[model samples]
Target: MRPVRGRWLSWLVGIAVALGFAVSALAQDEGYCGDEGVWLQILGSGGSELTDQRSAASYLVWIDDTARLMVDAGSGAALRFDETGADMAGLDAIVFTHLGAATTADLPALLEGSVDAGRKGLLPVFGPSGNDLRPAIGDFVERLIGANGAYSELSSFLTFRNAAGYKLSVREVSATGQRRWSRFSSDVLKLSAIPVHHGGIPALAWRVEIGEYVIVFAGSFSNQRDRVANFAKGADALVVSHAAPEAARGELREYHAIPSQLGRVAARAEARILVLGNRTSRTLGRESQSREAIEQHFTGPLVFANELECWGLPDKEDELP
Candidate 1:
C-alpha cells in the first residue's frame, strides 16, 4: 500500500509539472507574437459546386489581430467566420468579387451576425457594376434587403440607428475596362480594384497592400491576362481560383484560368507566393498534375488554401544601403 501511494503521488507531480510548463510556454508565445502582424484566413475555399469537402469562396484579412476586411461572403462563410472567434465589430469593409450566389449569398447572414455581436456604425461594401446580364451591386443589395424584398426585416434589424446599430453602404464599380480604382486607403492599408473578364459577367479583382505586404485576389478572369498581370504586379501573395483545369474549353475557359495559365500569370506578376483557392473536386483530385504544371512557370511557394486556415505574412527584408 505504501509503494502504490508513492507511485500515485509521483504521477500526479509529473502531470502538474507538465501542465505548468505548457502554460508557461503558451504565455511566452502570446507575449512574443501578441497581435502585431497581418494575417490572412481562408473562411471558405471551395468553388460554386455544392460539396461536403469545402465551403464556397470567402476570406478574411486580419491586421494587428483585428479582422478588418472580408472578401466574399459566400455560402457557409458566416458560420466559418464565427468559428474563428474574430470580433465582427472589427470588420470595416467587405468586397465582393461578383454577385454570384456562391460569392455573396451569405452577406445577409454575416450582417445579421455582426449586428448580433454588437457591431455599430456603417460597413462599406464594394462590388462590380451591372452588365447586360447582371444587376449592379447597389441594386443587388436592395433586392436582398429592401423594404419590399427578401430579408427586408434585415433593414430594420441592422441599421446604424437601430437597437443592434449597424448598416451597410454599397458601392458599385464599372465593369468595362482594365482601369484600376482605389477602393479604400488608410495609413496602414490601401485597396484597389480592377474590372476583369468573366464570361461577359461583371467581375472584379482586388489588390490590398498592408504595410510592406501586398496580396492580390485574381477573381475569375481568363482572357484578360494582361489586366491580371498588371493588377498583380509584384504581389507578395497572389490568390487564383482553381475551378477550371487546363482541359477546360469553350465557355468554361472564358470564365476561369487553367492551372498552367494560373502559374504563368503568377510568374508574370512576379508573385512571391501563389495561393490556389476556390478549389473543386476536379481540381483537388488532379492536385499532383496541376502542381507540376504550375511549377513549370511559377517557382514561388505554392499553397492550397483550405477552409479556416490562417497564413502569416512574412516581413520584407530591407534593401541594401
Candidate 2:
C-alpha cells in the first residue's frame, strides 16, 4: 500500500508540472476572443513558392478544441498540420480556394491521416464548381482513395459525404459568382464562399462568420477587385495574398492588388484587422510598403503572417458592438 501511494503521488506531481508548463507556453499563442471567443491559427501562410520565406497556401481556423475550417492545402501544409498538434477529428470542413498545385497539393496527405485515425466516410469539401475547382476535388479524392483512387484499397476505410451527410449527394458547386453557406455546429461558425481570381482559373474566396466576427479570405485576385470588395466590406478580419505592392504597380497591373489598393479596400469596408498572407520576397522585404499603402487609406491593426503563427478574434468588449 505504501509503495502504491508513492507512485500515485509521483504521477500527480508530474501532471501538475505538465499543466504549468502548458499554461506558460500557451500564454504567447492564446488570448481573449471576445472575452470568451474563437481563436484562429496559421497552419501555413506561404505562397505557391516553397522558400525559407514562404511555404504555400493554407490556414487553419479553430476555436479551443474544435477545428472549424481548413482553407487551401498547400505543398507543406500536411506536415504543418501534424506540427500544429491540434485535434484533427475536430476538423469539420475543408475549403479549397482553387486547384493551383500550391492550393490542393497536400489534400491527399490530410485525408489519409483522417483515415488512419478511423474516419469512416467522405469528408465535406466546399469550393468552386467547374473543371478547375469542382472536378479537381473529385479527381483528387478519387485518385487518392476512390475505387481507382491512387490508394483505393486503403482509401476504402473512409467515407465522403455532403454537408447533409449523404454520400451520393456530395455535389460540389464550383461556379464562379455563386455562393454557398455552411454552418459548423460546435463553434456555431458559418462560412460563405465566392469564386475569386486565381489567374482566371476556378478559384474561390470565403467569408466566415462566427457570432458577430467576420473573416474574409481573398484568394489570388486576378479578376474584379470590386466584386471581392463587396464581400469583404465591414469584415472583422480580412486576409489577402500579398503579391503586389504600391512601388511595383506597373508590374502588378495584370493580376494582383497593390498593397495600397488592398489597404484602400479594407479601409473602405471598415474592416477591423488585416492579415497579409501568400506573401513573396519582393513584398516581404518592402513589408513597409504594404503598411504605408494601407495606412494611406485605412487605419486599423495589421499583421504579416508567418508559418505556424496563431491569432484570435478580438474580445466582444473590444469592439463597438
Candidate 3:
C-alpha cells in the first residue's frame, strides 16, 4: 500500500490529524524472496473500515503473478486486490483466520470472481471449524458457495456451478496450544495452517512456505504472540496486526499486541522482517503513541505497511541464525 503521504495525509488531517502520519511507509525499496522469487503484498491494514492510513486486514502472497493465496477478505480487500493488478485466475486458494465481521466480509466479491472466471471446480478454502458463538466453516461455505449461496444467481452471466464453487476442507485444531500444520498443494507454492488464540474464537494462522521463503500471517488474537512465536519461529517474515507499541500493553491487555511486544516476539522467534496491520480505530494521538512504542522495541527490518505494499525477505538463507 502506498504510504498516506502528502495529499492523503492532508485529507486525514481534518479527520484524525496525526493518525495519518503515525505509521509512515518504509522508503520505496525492492523486495526479495531469494534469487528473484515470490513476495507478500498487503492489500488492506485497518481493522474495521478502510481508512486513509489503513484498510481492514487482507493480504495476497504470490510468486510472480502466479502461485497466489489470499488470507482474509476484510472490507474492501477484493477491490483493493484488484487494484494491485493481481490476476484473479492466478489465485490458487484462500484461507480465513477467523469469522469476525471485519475478517470475513469479502466473501461475496471473491466468489463472484470465481463465477466470472468460469472456473472448472471448487476453490479450496481452509479454516478452523466455527463454534457456537461464530459461524462454522460449513455455514460460512453455504453462505457463499452452497446452492443457496449468498450471491447465488445474481447475474445471468454468473454461473456458480457446484463444480465451479468453493470446496471447503475444514480442519479442527486442538483447543490447547498444540499446533497442527496442513499443507496446500499448488503449482506456485505450499500453504500451511495452524490454529492460534483469538479469544475463544475459531481462528487459524497461516504460514505459506514457497520455495525457500516462508511468511507467517496471524489473525486477531488475545494471545497471538506466543502462538505465532512457537509456530512461525524463525520464519523469514511475520505479517501481523500493528495494534500498538510494546508499552501500550496496558491498553492492549485485552486483545492485541503493541508493536514493541510484537517486535520482541518476532525477535525471539528469529523472524527477520516484520510487517504490521489491522490497526484499531483509536484517535490519532493514541495511535502515534503506540507506533512510537513499537519503534523502540524492534531494531530489525521493520515496515509500516499500506494497502498493496509489496515486501519480502532480502535473502532466504539469511533468515537462518
Task: Identify the leading candidate in terms of TM-score.
Answer: 1
Q: List, residue by residue over 50-152, the lDDT tens digit for candidate 3.
A: 4446668898875754438888888888787666666556677778888776877877776566554544444566766777767676676666645577655
7-75: candidate 1 lDDT, tens digit per residue: 111222234345642111121111111165776777888986866478897888778867788989888
lDDT of 3: 0.62
How many backbone overlaps does candidate 1 show? 0
Q: Estimate each model's TM-score.
A: 0.86, 0.77, 0.77
What local distance difference test score does each model get?
0.74, 0.63, 0.62
RMSD of each: 10.4, 9.6, 7.0
Please give the ranking of all candidate structures by TM-score, highest first, separated by commas.
1, 3, 2
The model with the greatest lDDT is 1
Model 1 clashing residue pairs (backbone): none
Ranking by lDDT: 1, 2, 3
Q: By summed lDDT, which 10 consecutive residues of candidate 3 come out lowest?
A: 4-13
lDDT of 2 at 225: 40
